[model samples]
Target: MKEIKRDLEKFAAEKFDLIIVGGGIYGIMLLLEAVRRGLKPLLLEKEDFCGKTSHNHLRTVHGGLRYLQSLDLFRFRDSIKERRWFLKYFPEFTGVLPCLMPLYNKGIYRKSVFRIGLPVNDILSFDRNFSVSREKHLPGGKVLSKEKTIELFPSVDTNELKGGMVWYDGCLTEFQGFYIAALKLAVQMGAKALNYVEAVGLIRQNDEVSGVKGKDRESGKEFAFNAPVVINACGPWSRDTAGIFEKDYPRLFKKRKLLWNVLFDREALSSHALGLRSKAGFVYFFHPWKGRLLVGSPEKLVEKSEAETVAPFQKMEEFIRDINEIVSGLGLEYKDILRVYPGVLPAEPDGSFSGRPAFIDHHKNGGVKGLYSISGVKFTTARLESDRVLGRIFRHKKAISYDEMLSKKEICCHSMAYDWQPNGEDDLEILKKIIKEESVVHLSDLILRRTSLGDNPPRALAILAKIRSLFDWDNKKWDEEVDLLRKQLREGFPNQKPRGAGNR
Candidate 1:
């Protein structure tokens, strides 16, 4: 928190080569890249970093095997490369996840098809596990007999259950830590970032974007940040952020698609992630992460404006019903859901590209200059997209090698903190360190994103009073914080109702 205040002062005074609005994964990664290449950069987030779409991801670094179905070898290669890069660089935060797809006597999901497809997948991602640690190595896909499938997923439907195909993909054990670690690295590399700051409008000169008009959410003090180039990487709020520029590019903004996932504590799905097709024919992932089963299928498109978006409670029930009806013997009920993660990603009305384009709309192409907006989709490819965006902006500049960037004296990149358990029960010391270093402005930021406590509501709420005391908040301040967190939890995870609601 103190560091954020100091950086805010510094940001107000300096002129940056690049100013990025939105501190989601894309914006964070872009800031890291810009600083690595010796460019002055500033990043502002309206809320806490990775508090939205980036934090609600399925936690998988997909290897693009899905693209093989469309015969898109280029995309397959790109996905595999990004997957391998993350596994190699952030070994502490990621690992290889075993994914299973049950085979039936049907189209695409059959042993015969996998027998051919698995080898093709292996050929396409031949170097997927190259130079990776032995424990993190992703072996080639293989077919499992029906008996073996039943042993792994005990509740498999016996009717025409031929077998299953197993493949390996990367999974993030601690997504929030990875994102914050990236931002910290950027800071060490001379990048400035401040959360709870919003770009309310654009500072323009002669119809060209020259800077940004920002308002500190806490202080309500407005300031202008002068920059030659400004990038808008707002995730779900892309449309609203673009509106600040006062430009009407009708197709420039699209309604965001809301993807929802329900977590079950029973571990009914076990360790492996299962790919199951719903009755509606949409593919849903059933994976066990951190002792919970996560399930979700087709993404629901939001009918309301982004600001008014909220996941209806009915959707959570629907998710449970859909999974139970399709997969036999797994009688999951609404009460079984421990939490719900519903997040949005921008998309065209026709559902084209699915918000994966990184729409680097250099407004010069549409009348306004020095302004760009990005629509990020997948979490797995954020780094790849950042490289592309910076490549275009700094095309002629001499590029710095990854090795050189790491060798810099100031860059102190470390493995994710939550990747391994602490040697002792030093909760107070750990909490104090997080509050001091991680820009924890709100109680939810401290619990939800900074620590693992937020995942378990009982434990989090039990320690709320202690956290309040540690922060030295008055009763009124503490109540306000708890109220804000309650509102957020209700909308974000309805199952984990307010403290006294007894919904659980």
Candidate 2:
């Protein structure tokens, strides 16, 4: 079976039941669901699949415990069902994560609040363990004593401490690998996916959208993909992309808010994911990720033009300051941040992120038929929302078997850190595998997307020559590719340089 490939000529030649305009997690899941339901879906990505805004996730598969604050049990249970789907389907890449939030008598963080809330959360999601594997079963919520909480995590603040709340959720062991696996399954099941294909505009026939007009980014050529239905699943760019329609319809996406997370070089502070409230009462999560600390979710309202991949310097500084204020003992400096993960989410009129996964059938709203756009809120529920919403359009009696889809082996991408090092026997072999099969177009695509080599700059810098040896680029092209890679890396860490790259 074909792993992800860029055969725009072949893809554009085929007829499709549906055309999806983004290759983020939502689009990927939608394409897979479309295939499982016996629909021919073609997905187009402007860049490498999941290499843009969608790649910057905090890696937590949320179960919506926070929604319990407002007694939004409907959403909470929906999150539980979705979280179970990930654990049950992708068991190898996802697992149960123990979550702890220290109570400090702050508004909702107090023990008295959770004493009643925990049991209700348990009662509502009682069927959470219904079909999941024995190893992946999630235990009910619990409230720990102040001393026991401190025993489990000593770094939490003790001033006005009211105890701790412990619960379980799912976390992606390998974020990119899990996403790529889904895409691979979609490809195997007959969904057409091509990256480096940009959607220039829509092709409409009177009151209906017949296809999408696209441009191949790899080659400067234009093409058309004709489908009965077109879906705009471009995450943050949905609003801007919808502008191309230029119809007298309601705006598909409202103003968006910038949400960011910081990956500190320090090791995990505790075995469980810790949620501590700042002096200003905003709660922040500092979780243990691959032996490192990952803290998140500083937010700001930004206009459509101002949405960017990196958070502003002052905003990030304030975010780190807030984190330091909550846990002064662990002074996390800016230099300690290895990477900054940023993305934008559709916000309420008041800039709050309290919305659900939303979609607009432009046919019903104001524009042409067969044109629909979706604005996704969370990654945890992308699969659930995709199935629920798309089922309305393509109804069938056949049930989708997760075992059949996930169990079948396909040629998928894997992290090359184990094999891409110096003196490794398969250094060249694995690099060739990624390039030959994984739709690699540039050196940065190989380093940043197909593998996790870019996660560690020094190691990636050291492996440049081996990577170069696999490609046939000469002189100017190699230098240009290296310069592009450096420019992309510098966006995350402005001060990052080639450290110890030549030492070997």
Candidate 3:
């Protein structure tokens, strides 16, 4: 990775085939596609990778099951295709999550309507030739009796409830981790990907994009990169980045908006993800993660500038409060909350969401002949989205397909089946011996980032003494890291009050 960074530094001093702005899922996916085609692309991010809406997503790899009302057959089909591809290629990061649509008397779609719709969805998926398993992948949906619905979700509002429907979908364990892995893969494939670098403006020549000029946010140093093709894949900021190029030259760009929110709670709702409808709109998927429940996604229109705006703390609290009221009306509470966040979905001026039909436009008349803009799409469908965009950009006779690297067996291998491995006695003994020799501080470093133990502080420190002896670190470094961790914990949780204050 360090070597890749150094190479990027050298490349930035010269011109390149393509330079991609934005390090979100879309940008990273495009970078990977370019690298796979031997393009050696350069990728830039203004913040950490997946630092925006990607990280803030509800984590459901949905198939647009609700789009039937709008009759967006194209998007619905695209989502189905993308969902299958993600499950096939990234099984280690994805899973077939059971999803329940709790039917209510006041809902938009009735039981018979859903029964008919499920078969239609299956037929569309089949006609598209997508490899979604009818038996295992979706199970074609089933009708649950009112008693069964209450049995499944004991806290559901029975007055409003009218049985339910069960189906299958996918969910990600760690949204940021998956994208970061993709970014790392891009770096590994000889692509230049730098985080924390801001692209201040476009480098134009004779009214076309030549490259970009920006400074390193960490070092406060200026730099320039030259490229024949510059792609704007900045998600919600796509328009803003395009404006930088359009200022000196006339260019075309459109802006659209969508919003999502994540609420944390832990009620005894079914383990399956739930998609429900309310008076406002469809509320999709309340699922458990890291000991908390996440529900979301209220769609609304907003100015492009407000793309990365955080939801008001009170607004988020109110959202959870409303859910709690519904749950409590059936019986749950507000004590379940842990956190809240907001996300944006960029759309086109025609009131169409980005990524469904896929947008790939190039500015041939601009000073830079190959300036392009690729926008809109969900994370699950990232690979397909990239394939379409790159196909337009390269105009190649043929390009590699995701299937060449991914297979059903490989996908299953990567899934949760391999996540929890039990080490034998010999391995455990070796680990203990290594820990005894290395010492606690070095062990802390190893376990914190390298292993998943850092998510829980108590478990993280429990093995510290064992790890301390392995590295043979004296007390000094151990104490230093411990103090640093303590400070980090305190700073990371500014709003959390100290325990026992209320009782006092």
Candidate 4:
């Protein structure tokens, strides 16, 4: 990993083949694809890499099994292909997660539906286990007896507990690390990826985009980079970014789905991810990760402005109440939550889950030359989506065999020496390396995104002084960063109150 500040001068001087805005997983994928094809690509992120929507996923490398509901085989295969890559190539950050969806009635959510669906799904994903390691290999789905379901999930509603269906899926063990690893690989493969760099506007030659003008958050200095093509891979912010140039940009963003996932401190399940329908009939995933209960997906649409931030306390309270009602044994409340993973995703014009990524060539659709925008559907298929976008961007170029480089396994930042220690005292050497290379402009970058300390509030608070000492931040700077992090945690965490007590 290299610091963006150190290479700022070179970055400004170079005329690159492609300029990608947004340092989320989608941007990272584009960077990787660009470099593999021997194209000079520059990646810019307004915040820390993977700090926003990309970091707050359910941690599942979806295998397209969910797409069966819509009978979308194209998306289903795409997910299976990407999931296979993660399970086979990045075993360190990906794992086989067994999921159980309990059947309660003789409707769509019944055992008979799964009994036929699982085998068909298995056939569709027949090549899923190809070249995958034994330990990471995913097994096909099977029906569980009612008694077995009761044994597995003691809190399951018994009114119509007609057994359950068990299926296998892949989980992203450490998303922050996994994303960083991908970016680092792209950097190593001759792509320039810079964090904390915001692309304020597009540099256009007449109607065609030439490059971008960006501001470095660390120094507050603005710089420019020239490129023939620019891609808007900003995920939820795709339309907003493109709006800088093209007005009436086909309204790429139809609706913003505010997806929220809550993590509880206490153990909610012994093992296996439990999929249950909420009282409102929406499917909720109750999965165990890092000793916490992860539940989500009773999605609600919100205004684009409010979609980027955390959900309101009232909404969170409502979610908690719904969960409590569905699984009375857990009896969870807002106080039990450790953190709330909140993010916004692009939806169909009618505000439905399209379940497929959208790629737009601004030149073709919006009449803006040399500009393109991509809105991804899910994290699992980001790589495949990037490949498709690249195919359109470099239309006639034959792809190089960079499989070996792309597939190389990497250790996530958290898995480095000193492990989960948030305080810098535990491992000074690794801490210094991270601070220097990973572009630590703020304390939150280190604690919240780069390390696991941010996941645990008390631990992050305990290590503040140590971090201050390690980074050599002045009192004023240290205080500012700490205050900002506290504010962010308050909004991001479930237990903490929103910014203004009177407002909430």
Candidate 5:
């Protein structure tokens, strides 16, 4: 892969077709989509790519299994389409994941509902395996016998446990590396992308948005890029970013909620990603990610400011208690949480997450022309959503399929390389190449965002010195970066009390 070449001068010099703000999944996909249609696009990120909410997912790609609840065939097909896209295109980065939900005798969580539901789902998604490789192919959902469910999940709560319904899904195996790979592909296809550059404001001439006004966070130097059109795909901060449009700007979010997943540092509970309903009737999922039990999706209305993404301590305690209650003998507690991936997402007034992706053209809204905003709650359909947004722009040229690039071997940065190392550090050659290309602005960029050493803060701290030789930082600069990375880790993984004895 060619170096990401962080060039501010080149950014200011180029006159682009589109200027995309926000380097999260949505923004990155939009940038790639623009390029695929032969449009020159410039993408800017305030921090490293996927540094915030995008990196906080459970890494499981949903295939609209829940949409079956309401018989939403359109969504079911759309989800299966995107899930298949991820599997077929990025074969190295995506994988088939079987997800099981423990069945109960009563309520909607029973086998009878899914027996019909699964067949309908399978029939609608008949084309799921079209063009997909054999290894990545998804199997039809099935109803497991109660004895089989007991065999798989030995400690499951048996109060009314009938059996289980297991469905297939996809997951990002490379974590943030998938984000980085798509970004690298965009850059290779003649798109310009820069990290640590903030889009401060929009440059509007009359009613048309001329371009984006940007500032380098490291140097405090400002620059402007000219583009006829601009898009705001800035996840949680999208509201704040588009706030510049002022009153009459349509409300982007009806409501907001704090969504988070906890990476419990315990042995994984099952081979298949498991879902179980608590006594409170909230269905919680347990994902087996990189040997840890990744449990998630506890949500509440946005009580705190959007910036406070760290989940509340009391809420986390409650989440742990709920999980423990679902499976007997699985006595988990707060300290068992090695890392908590938290983010803010748009929600409905009743606290249900907004299902649809929203994209707005300001000109249509009677606001600034040549400017648009997009916010999507789910990551699985980001590419499809971007294609829809850009399909409106360049209507003639078709969006390129990622399957086209299958013949070529693209460069990928495995962010979690350190995790697999027998020793504490990654291979020196791999680290050297990452430092040379992938825009290494700080130690935290490499440790946290670029490589997932940040997933386990304490482990990242332990391996910090081992990789010190990769950076050219002097004593003082090195110490400063280390301190900053430590502070960031502490904030993301708060309440670092040790796991109590016999708590497992």
Candidate 6:
């Protein structure tokens, strides 16, 4: 990975075939594809890679079973293929998750209708041995008696209980970990990827894109890199950045909006993801990971101005209440939530899903012949989306075959291998060591992002302090980081009061 960084720095000093703006999953995936094609690609991120919506994911590599309702067969097929690909290539992170769909005596879809849909889903799996009997990891579709339903989901309301259907889907244990792994792979393949570099402008000559101008956010120094092709894979921010180039070519731009939400710790209701019909829309996937449960609302169009807006606090609270009311076994409250995040989904103005099918537009009239844009793909389909975008950018040539790239394997970039494991008895000692080494401040960052402590927050502070004691930092550094974290907590979480204030 370090070698790839050095090579990228060298390429940036000269010229490159591709300069990709945005370091999220889309940008990183493109960088990987380009470098594998022997194209020296430079990737820039305004913040840490996967720091935005990529980090905030439902963690399910869905097979698009829900899309069957909309009859969006193309997306459904692409998702299933990609799910299989990820499971095949990265089995360590991806796995088949058994899901239960508990039915009520009074509900929308009947058993017969679901039975028909189940066959469609099975067909979409390409006859690849996903049957319940063949795949024991997944529960087969069966109607359970009321007594059996209680055994299956003990917490479900018995009064409304009917039998339920069990099925299978794929899940990623950690979305951030997956992206970070991909980033490491891209670096290994000779892609230059640097985080915290903000792209400020598009360098053009006579209305053609020549390269990009950016500033190192950490150092506040500006730098430039030249490339014939520049890709805008900035997710929600793609349109805003593309508009800068579109200013020179007024005829080539449009925008659209999309919204998603997350609800945590509500997964105790079912062993696998669940789908339910709600008055608002279809509620799919009550996904459980580690200890938290996540639920998402359907994707609906919103105004561009409200694109980045999050679900209101009250609305999120209501969502939690409603979900709890629907799912018998799961019980949660607003206080159970750790955080709420919102991101935009970009699209075009023609009332079509601009990026859903992986929209790619080339701007040759303005001098930048290789400038391309990719938008509208969910996490499950990132690999295929990247392949599609790169195919368009590379003019439909096989940039680098997947088999060859996987065959030349040089490194194993697994986080679990490097992460600290505590001897059951020495957990305190290990925790202290981690805190000391990382100089952790806020309990949330320590537990949530850094370690698994946030999942069980009651012991987070003590664990944090223990971890901190292991580091040999001077009192001054400790105090500084603590102060910085306090300020961050105050600003980032205005509602939550500081815990154990006297500890400071």
Q: Please name the candidate that would achieve the greatest TM-score relative to the true structure.
A: 5
* Models, CA RMSD each: 3.1, 2.7, 6.4, 3.1, 2.9, 5.2
For residues 1-504, write the lDDT of model 5, one tens digit per residue.
767778998779889999999999999999889978888999999988888888888888888878888878788788989998888878778888888888876777778888998888888889998989999999999999988988887877767678998889999877667777788888888889889999988988888888888999989999998899999988877877888543323356767788788877787788888988888888788887866788888986875354457777778878888888887798897667767778888877777788898788877877888888999978898999999999997778776656564356476646453354425344767767777888889888887776767676567777666788888889899989887776666554446643321121
- TM-score of candidate 6 relative to the true fold: 0.80
lDDT of each: 0.75, 0.78, 0.60, 0.78, 0.80, 0.60
Misplaced by over 4 Å in model 1 are: 1-6, 250-255, 306-309, 352-355, 407-425, 493-504
- How do the residues 1-504 of candidate 2 rate in per-residue lDDT, one tens digit apiece? 677777788878889999999999989989988987878889999988887667777788988777887778788888999899988887767878999998876676778888898888888888888889999999998999999889888887887777899998889866767877788788888888888888988998888888999999878799999898988888887876777854422344566778877777688888998887777777788878766788888888887677376687788778889988888698888767766677887777877784686688887777788888887888898988888768866665253677776666553445443224745657678778768866788888877776677666667777787667788888799989888777665554324422322233
Q: Per-residue lDDT for 135-154 in model 6, tens only?
A: 32333355556676667667
TM agreement with the true structure for every prediction: 0.91, 0.92, 0.76, 0.93, 0.94, 0.80
Mind giving the per-residue lDDT tens digits that candidate 1 earns over 30-84?
Answer: 9988987789889989888888888777888999888999888777888999999
Q: Candidate 5: lDDT of 457?
A: 58
Q: What is the lDDT of candidate 4?
A: 0.78
Show where candidate 6 strays beyond 4 Å: 1-11, 105-108, 127-145, 248-267, 277-284, 298-310, 328-331, 346-368, 410-494, 497-504
- Overlapping backbone residue pairs in candidate 5 total 1
> Over all chains combined, what TM-score does candidate 3 have?
0.76
User: Between candidates 2 and 3, which one is better according to lDDT?
Assistant: 2
In terms of lDDT, the poorest run of 10 residues in model 6 is 411-420
For model 4, where is the 10-residue window of minimal lDDT? 495-504
- Model 5: residues with Cα > 4 Å off, grouped in runs: 245-250, 303-307, 413-418, 422-426, 493-504
Kindly give the stretch of ten consecutive residues in candidate 2 with the minimal lDDT sum. 493-502
